[model samples]
Target: MSAIVNRLAPANAVVPEQQPSAVAGLRLETRIVDGAEWDRTIAGFDEVCQEQLHVFATARWPSVKQEPMLFLADGQVVGGSLMMVQPLPLRIGHIAVSKWGPMLKDSSAPHAAALRDAMVEALIADYAERRGLMLSVLPRAALETDNSAYERLLARGFKRGSELGFPSRYIVRLGLSDAEQRKSLQQKWRYHLNKSEKAGLSFEHAGPERMGEFDRLYAAMSERKQFPDHSAYDTVPLLMALDIETLRPELFFVRHAGEVVAGALIFKAGDRAVYLYGATNDTALPLRAGYFMHWQIIRWLRDNTRAGWYDLGGTDGFHGLHQFKKGMVGEAGVITPVPPVANYAARPWAYLLGNGAFWARDAAYHIRRVVTGALRPKARPDQAPVVVEAGQP
Candidate 1:
């Protein structure tokens, strides 16, 4: 799941709650649209990510409004952005969020670094530098980690957010042989995978035909656990409609005895697969169904499909969620963080609200768990589990 952070509270669904900030200074031209052309414009950029797609924006902003923003230098496109602007659930003012984007590059140009710098400078002067509205961006980790990109973003006033979630994705390279891949996993993870194998759980590619099953398991898990659910945006209908070869949403489950106990839904785009959503029955927790599902998917991506990379999703503190990924993918897997420099500082109130909302959300989670007597899952013998999502690990 994508770590969500910002949106704008539009007064009416059709127009911006805050008036559009006028463009000034420099010869940079700008255009914002809510059309099919956004997809065509961003096609084939080095920074391509699923969240940057037009259909993804549609899935995400089903209830809110979204605009695709472009920065043009002379007659050429310098930067492209997709913003999901909407109010928070409780009527607090809105916040705007941009994830793994504004594809900051010029495909047809020379000196990509120089062009990107110029485009970002204009982007800063245009959007982030102006008002104090609630705006947060989780740029490509490649951009945030590089010395030049890191320095430029900080100079523009983006404060890093959390180390977990959108800031970083846990990625495992799939170029290794099966034995090497198994070795990369933590020792215990391998043992557990073997143990789960003895349980004889079966794997099935239950795509869109099982959407309701995926939805019900997902919703149940969301309520029983504390992980954020942006799966609402990347719904079954949208995923099922996509071409299976270029991009496919896959569902794999672990069936024990005769019943389905755990499942995962992942998206394969190009040569990469990202875990989008997953579910498990609490009663079957000890069976390590989640482990089976994840391992099977990783193996499948490596052996059965063209996908050469597998993203095990993001961190959730040290909770079962993060620990599970770490155990399965091990140290060789890279964790991609959104980085603080790209989280552009929010308006003071918006900052407070964002943090407040986060704290309150966690607070409610703990309270509910206590009321429900839900014990936290033990991650391993060496550490204490982060009590965020009990069922997730």
Candidate 2:
């Protein structure tokens, strides 16, 4: 397929400066629908999320049938949440999961508590009518403390789980303007950024037409890093298509010399922008193209948009990558806890078994990678493709 390329604005084109805004009110709503409806909802949500950095837009519940309940306030759709159920065999039961929201604005604890109450009430009402739903799980965004908002939910009968499954690194705030951003970075990172700039690295916005460049870079990294599954790269086309069709090209950026060498995929949900996917040529490491790419993207958002937090996604708590992201800027947010649903009713049991089977199927992915690597010879470096799909790079 021919790639879609967006023209870059002329160097002299005027780019407006960004200004910060205060928080706004909160509102809530719910929409229940089947697969088609869910898909449409997700697409719409994706557009908003890509611009806003809200987490609810990215969270997918495993279910053939789904109902998305959204939260709005002050006339703006601030949150997208849902209740999902998965079917199981032998009449055991179904699994239920609901999220309150990717609460956009930071509100007072009382206001947040009220929103949680309303969402939980809606969930209970929906759950009570369903026979197969044995247990319901809600993965809320992490908060800093045991406050009234959380306390209210627990008081309302929801129990805290022992484990936090969806723990995300907290928001890192890199100030607007390249100079200010550079000043905020640690001395060593700043040194690398300077070195990268001296190497003649530059960044550009990417679109569908240039997706091939992204794909090539991503595939090269995947092979070198020995990534366990190719699906991470496979999802590129879909995500890029989604980005373009939704008019959110700011979600993607590429760094290059005369040709693309490294890139990253970013997603904005609300006031948050997430650093999602990235890949670079190992040859570009010394130039620190990755560092330059990240620095530029963060500066753009900080200067041109209302985004407040940049999520580096997930990482091994103590890994080098995690530490690198930490050094970028911003305080860490709460770790998302994923607790098992406690209900053991037959319906729930069936759902778990079936879902577990699906999980096992996914787990086999690493083994497949191992076999594929062992059987297929590596492509010669000289024969590497010039362009690849979008998100992969």
Candidate 3:
């Protein structure tokens, strides 16, 4: 199997200047940022995904070298990204990847589009041309009527890449009033929530100390359904224990008869909150605890984080999970992120080889997941599969 990466630019497209280049009055530069500095810088952005956070990078790629780059205008920060770089064999070059960035300070401003282009161009100048690295970016643009960000990447000689596994997410706008939020729920979903409320189920915003309870429920559900446990169990505790108050991940649980039956781990950064992982046992399914758990988390986000959006994460081709998420956010909330696009930089041949290796490895992983899932034994008639959202690194 060949590892595939995003496609490269047309062989004839002229590469931009390799040095620091100003675009639309924005100057791009790199900085040596500690955890506090990284957190403080990203706090001002309007949209920040968990992948861009320092804790996430530390936990997901502890051994990889990370670079923090910022886009400044008039000596003020306007955009930034946290990039993780892995050196290719024998110093041929490095493969640099940025997920859900470079995030802009104000994406709704009149000059926001131009600012975004400048950020992308600067990345190209520094990583691709000057450093001769293969840079792949998952730009933080939604699948919306406005696609200028996607277009800009292509215009700048980036090659389109595969989804790398996840293609889309369902994001619900959280700025709505409580009444409006409920109104947005699909009719059947609303009904389930109503029923769960009458079922004597108790929802709590739990702390990291209750992780033991969550682990037990998750393990029980996994065994009952005979499915692989892909939850971020190892990293959840670390995120939950972060010293930063606003940046810490939240753990929520739903209990029936004083026993925990379901749990969810959510991570928030900037104005966005993402559903990282979830699990429910048979006891929870009957009570519709999943719906109730998510609702409580949504309300908590509204009151505490003031986050503007909630991402339900990827559904992993599970029909039940897709239907479940669609009921909460509706079809309109579904969004496919821009696929990772790569710039070959100065060493086009090196980029091609590195991306090829990545593509092959990703393809093989999905194939194995499909095979393993199919071979799992059927669950008991009364049991339902645990709801696990596919999380990104």
Candidate 4:
């Protein structure tokens, strides 16, 4: 009863003989799809990221046009991305952005490298060479290291930019046994976790109806910290309201003295589960509710989901927050994302004008941030137990 269907290329289809070895037997297809179908198709993939989901993209970029792209080899769908297309100023062309995607059915497969290369080449051909748009791709944070996909992108003339999709983050590897996972925590972190367990706190898997309560907690925390509200609060409700199971977030709450003290929202897609937003009130710090809340989350992910890694999100520039996350991630889980890369239009003038305008916009954005004091780093209270909600820094 699944909506996904595999379509073969026409009999007269031309093979990409001149392209890289990976491009052979690989075909990329684009289709206009409804929301249900889009969700169904992508959900079937092995690694689905929130950014590549229909609900997230529609909520995150309401104005930009979204296109669904599918990758196939030997007539079977293997990978795809929900691409966001933005028109350049003065009608120069367009900028196609793909964030944290195109997800594959099995990134660990033997043919993954070649499939990824073919996807990159197809992306360039469709967006840059044929349609004459700038194709900008920001791979998932985990792909930041000596990734073959990134190297392939550079080999195909994609220019690397300083903009990163994710800053340095901490991810807990969930493959460890429960005892080992706890032991992996820093000595102090484990001590506090034990203390929190004895503090008479309770944990619950909150339902979508509790989103209003979460928003209230988040709003109060943002006001108290005087920091920017980077949580996905605006989009959480919409995603929660959807029928699509892949995009629904898992909400965990901690209660002390019969009152909610802390809560964390996590989204799982593919093999990774990410901490989207977390909040704690003043009462939470005293009870060490944050520690209790995260421990429960870790245990839940390990017991329930197929996810192998849990991202703790970013810490921005807060020292205490960074230390707390580092303790949770241990030494081996810290990761710095690769910077975004862009493939420009085939025409020289279009590339120059388009690149110039994009930089101009970036400069203005930084100026605005400076004027608004958004770049100022606030010191986290030494005893603060949990990280606030985070997004791209």
Models, CA RMSD each:
9.0, 12.8, 7.4, 5.0
Model 3, range 1-393, lDDT digits (tens) per residue? 121221222322222333233232344443445655777677667876677877678777777787766666655677777888876656665788877887887777656766666677667766787677788887754646445566567767688775544455667767667788888888898899999999899888887888888878777877887866655567677677777766677889888998888898887766678888888888888899998898888888888876777888756666676678878875335454445564445576757866876777678877777677567634212223333222211
| TM-score: the better of candidates 2 and 3 | 3
lDDT of each: 0.60, 0.49, 0.69, 0.71
**Candidate 2 C-alpha RMSD relative to the actual structure:** 12.8
Q: What is the TM-score of each candidate against the true structure?
A: 0.66, 0.66, 0.83, 0.86
**Candidate 2 regions with alpha-carbon error over 4 angstroms:** 1-29, 33-63, 71-79, 89-91, 99-112, 128-132, 138-140, 143-151, 162-170, 174-180, 230-233, 243-256, 330-393
- Steric clashes per prediction: 14, 34, 7, 0
Candidate ordering by lDDT (highest first): 4, 3, 1, 2
Off by over 4 Å in 1: 1-33, 39-46, 62-64, 70-79, 85-97, 104-115, 128-135, 142-148, 156-168, 219-234, 242-248, 270-272, 303-308, 341-393
TM-score of 4: 0.86
Candidate 4: worst-modelled 10 consecutive residues by lDDT: 384-393
Lowest summed lDDT window (length 10), candidate 2: 13-22
lDDT of 4 at 388: 22
For candidate 2, write residues 226-289 as lDDT tens digits.
Answer: 6444333444455565533432434455445576678887765445566767888876787788
